[model samples]
Target: DRVRIFSRRLTDVTDSIPEMVDYAKTKVKASEFLIEGEVIALGEGGKPVPFQDLMRRFRRVHGVEDMVEKIPLRLYLFDVLQCDGKTLIDLPYTERWEILASLAPTESLAPRIMTRDPKVVNDFMQAALKEGHEGLMAKSLTSDYAPGARGKKWFKIKPSDRLDVVIVAADWGSGRRVGWLSNYHLAVRDDTTGEYLVVGKTFKGLTDAEFDMITKRLQELKIRESKWTVHVKPEIVVEVAHNEIQKSPRYKSGFALRFARIAKFRDDKTPEEADTIQRLRKLYEKQFENKGRLLKEVP
Candidate 1:
């Protein structure tokens, strides 16, 4: 039996994760089945690894077995849309969960609880964080699976890691942001070399007013400029929030910040007082105390 795993935009990524396909073929009871689930890379003691590890595993085309042995995967099925050639999308969330439970092994199902108590929800959220998960998804029991529409049927609750980084450069903006250096190049300092290592970039979490103000300050601190990007003196510091730090060859520091955005300006701190590359490295290394070498594909 053949199974297909389509990800965002319905892209066929089946070959990238043959292990999941194999599990679905042998473990899942349905002849024709469609399920919605989360697949995270597993680390030591079966704790979840950083999201970057999962991403690298998803991109493998060759040497997949090596990667698989390094970073095994675990799936948590939460919904089922089809089973045995019958459609189940019309079913409510709770009903679909029941169907999924019957088809998937108990250990393959997501940790489930039915409760309206805020204290219970809060405690569950804390537990998810402790398990190295981003957060929890709260789905309405009566709602149907509405594909491609993120309208209130489920709510995602996540907490981000924040760091104070300096702007080393900025690119010119287009469209409505034209005439403003809206996109920022964010970086952290290497204490040993006194160099600024770029971690990521973003044009988010800032208002037009704030953008205008920062543009003026950055232009004043400008040390050099090119056609599209203006390299600055790294004097302007700001607090930045991101989902995770990934091992990346794109930067000299071999680190990239995922989904980075400006949180707020840090006028109270000087560039010299900003967070350092060593701090980012510590967080990256902590993503796998014993498993990153085995599981993480360096990219």
Candidate 2:
């Protein structure tokens, strides 16, 4: 029996299963379907719920009924890949939408339609940023569904507010950084010239657990050793937050990143796909002009 149903991340449901069951009964056909959505927690005034609360829901395999009463969730559906015995992967996004829209009722349990219009997408991204969402995803309407494939068919536009860079080299930990592979040197690619240039470094954002996991992975990928640095295969991509960019002679590109902090490790991204030096130059220009305006306003 190939029944179709929608599934969301455990954290997204604000109501119990009984309530969702009732909602689903009215909204969907009695057939079996598997729908995917994100489960987020909501805060006061209809704000997105915290990740921690969502984690609790994920850990609860038993007592779901009781847990639902305690921890509510919000589901944001994005796609309908399969329905009954038919595969929606061969269908264009527009066709998929027709089936989904006709079948699924847009209520508290409904998922929002993701689009590719840059201007409209940008506006929605800004709203997501203000609402504390990590960022937005852009999918091409002509692309077929490719499960487990990191294809360009679905392009993610994460707030351009941060850079995902590769760890090219790392220095030995010292003092507090001792016993761990800290003090990283990050780099970005030159898409036009096929080169990598150092942009910044940081030793933050890794928990003890993360430290252990990354250290083990880094050691496995180690290629060469230097006096103060270990040159490893550039296999790790990390998201970084920065105050601004500046021109500098210390790096090959005549530029450097300032006040950089680790945001996250991007295991999904490849080193070759890291941001380019040209992109950095553009970002630096905007950051520099913004700083000048701030300085002028200061007393």
Candidate 3:
């Protein structure tokens, strides 16, 4: 069933250039179809531009025409939400994918491949990484499109360079951060023993507003407090970035992060969903293996 394809602009739902939306509308040969996809800004080298660069495009309202010329945007259509006057939300994703392929330009749509082989999947992941994609999303063919919902049926597999840890304790701020939590003690789960082991501490990469909000939230979950540190129940999950994992005798799991810093708060994730000590061990081992020898000296 073929119909006119018309894409509606969603400024609030996604951070995309308005010009890109207008361009999509112009490319629609059909007048009564709706497709869902991500809008990405492309660089001169035909690779994705940095996200901050795309944000710059979104903020410019006065000289949008010039900005659009400098930073081009592309849409990768993935699903069909509507066709003619009928809604396709109830249909399974595999069916909607077929409809999207039939209507959208082949060059504009993301490729869909079905496979169960892990080796093939690893090859695809490497290819996507080489092409500068964050990662690839794995979806169940039988799943339905759940709008505004995060479901386990979809998985995002990326490079194992980041870890999501939970905040177990925090220290009272001293200088500019006075009256707020300054240092956060992060922990990863020890699945075998069912315990959360403190790995490292960080107070970086958070805005003033985030510090204030987290202070209040942590206070709510606080169980014990001393003059400087307040021990709280594991509630807040945060993504942490580190140069490498090193052996540590100070903390459990016998590991620590080198130059650890807070990447972002994982509000969508819970403490139980945080990364595990086993995963950390695996990453540490992989790092050494990549270097062709084990790191005997720990930083």
Predicted structure with the largest lDDT when compared to the true one:
1
User: Local distance difference test, per candidate?
Assistant: 0.86, 0.67, 0.75
Q: Assess candidate 3 and give its TM-score to the true structure.
A: 0.55
Candidate 1 runs further than 4 Å off: 84-87, 287-299
What is the per-residue lDDT of model 1 for residues 35-119, given as tens digits with 9 covering 90 to 100? 9888888876788877766877777888888777887888888889899988888789888888888898999999977899999
Residues 30-126, model 3: lDDT tens digits: 5687677776666645666444455566666566666666777767888777887889988988898888877877888885578999999998987
- Worst lDDT run of 10 residues, candidate 3, spans 290-299
Give the per-residue Cα lDDT of candidate 3 at 42.
67
Off by over 4 Å in 2: 1-26, 108-117, 160-239, 242-299
Can you write out model 2's per-residue Cα lDDT over 35-117, one digit (the tens) per residue? 65565655444555434445555565567776665556565656677777787878887787677766676663343446557
Question: What is the number of backbone collisions in each predicted candidate, taken in the order shown?
Answer: 2, 18, 4
Models 1 onward score TM values of 0.88, 0.49, 0.55
After TM-score superposition, the amount by which residue 275's alpha carbon in candidate 1 deviates from its true location, in angstroms, is: 0.8
